[model samples]
Target: MMDKMMATLLESLHEATQRLEQAVAVKESNPDDWLAILDEREELIHQMQERFSAGSVLTEAQRVQLTQIYEVNQRLIPLIEGCKQGVQQQLNNLHRSKLAMNSYNEAGPNGYGAFFDRKK
Candidate 1:
């Protein structure tokens, strides 16, 4: 039974890492992917909680590996949050840049050459 539990945890760990990698991959492409990663992270935590409740019967190796995962995730969640913030900031900056360029065009030059001439 303990071995089974350990196996489950190991499997969960593997799946969680894969999910994390996927999240990172799609992070720049879509916000939905990041949200999915958050969900997966929660699921992984819940699995750990369930296993912990079942018993402290984990093998030394399992325990060590689990502890490492826990620590790594403790750092990783913050990094993910930072990534999300960065994506948001980049989107906002792009929007603002577009708006500024539009306003500049409306005010005078409608073309890049015209704007460059005005700048000189």
Candidate 2:
């Protein structure tokens, strides 16, 4: 039988995983919300590690629950990677546009040309 702390941590992990799934399912999910869920999951995992590393063994059910969490994570990896790539592409495009604008401004006609008016 799992200890109470372990059970609670596992339940929290399960809930975090559900939130992650929902976040991934939405096409326009907020990255901040997804990241918050991930952060919560990481904290729960750390808590579980601290609690379980004291020469404790997991019961079969606990092992199964962990395995399920692992499976869900595996499935999410590709989707997460895709999202990362999309964001990276957007950043790259923005950077290129900024550089182009900067170059254009640098090569542009400065106000010096307008200062010496021919009709002055």
Candidate 3:
């Protein structure tokens, strides 16, 4: 039973990594697709984390496998974070531009428009 649980946990981690890679690669092309990938990966990670927290004893080989997974994750996490930051920055810039345009389009005063500086 322990071996089975370990196998499932390792499998989950591996699959999550692969899916995360795909999401990162195509993030700009179709962000909606990446969102779906994120949902699936989150479920897998949750299951894997539960298994890991159960205090199961891992053999040397299993420990080695887990270590490899950890190393890969260490490298991938920062890259993913950077990608997320870039996407957020783009969204922020877009929102700022939209607000600026809206403000500029607002009537100057009393519907007189920007051409007239004084109502008289």
| Winning candidate number (lDDT) | 2
Per-residue C-alpha lDDT of model 1 across residues 1-120, encoded as one tens digit per residue: 466765776767766766675566564556676567668767866777776786746777777877777676676677778787897999999999999887666675445454443543
**Index of the highest-TM-score prediction:** 2
* Superior by TM-score: candidate 2 or candidate 3: 2
**Tens-digit lDDT track of model 3 for 72-115:** 66876787778778889999999999997666556365454435
TM-score of each: 0.54, 0.84, 0.65
**Residue 79 miss distance in model 3 (angstroms):** 1.1
Error of 2 at 100 (Å): 1.4
Whole-structure CA lDDT of model 2: 0.85
List pairs with backbone clashes in candidate 3: none
- In model 3, where is the ten-residue run with the lowest total lDDT? 111-120
Ranking by lDDT: 2, 3, 1
Better of 1 and 2 by TM-score: 2
C-alpha positional error of residue 112 in candidate 1 after TM-score superposition, expressed in Å: 19
lDDT (CA) per prediction: 0.69, 0.85, 0.70
Question: What does candidate 2's lDDT look like per residue over 32-83, in tens digits?
Answer: 9999999999999998889878655678898898899999999888998999
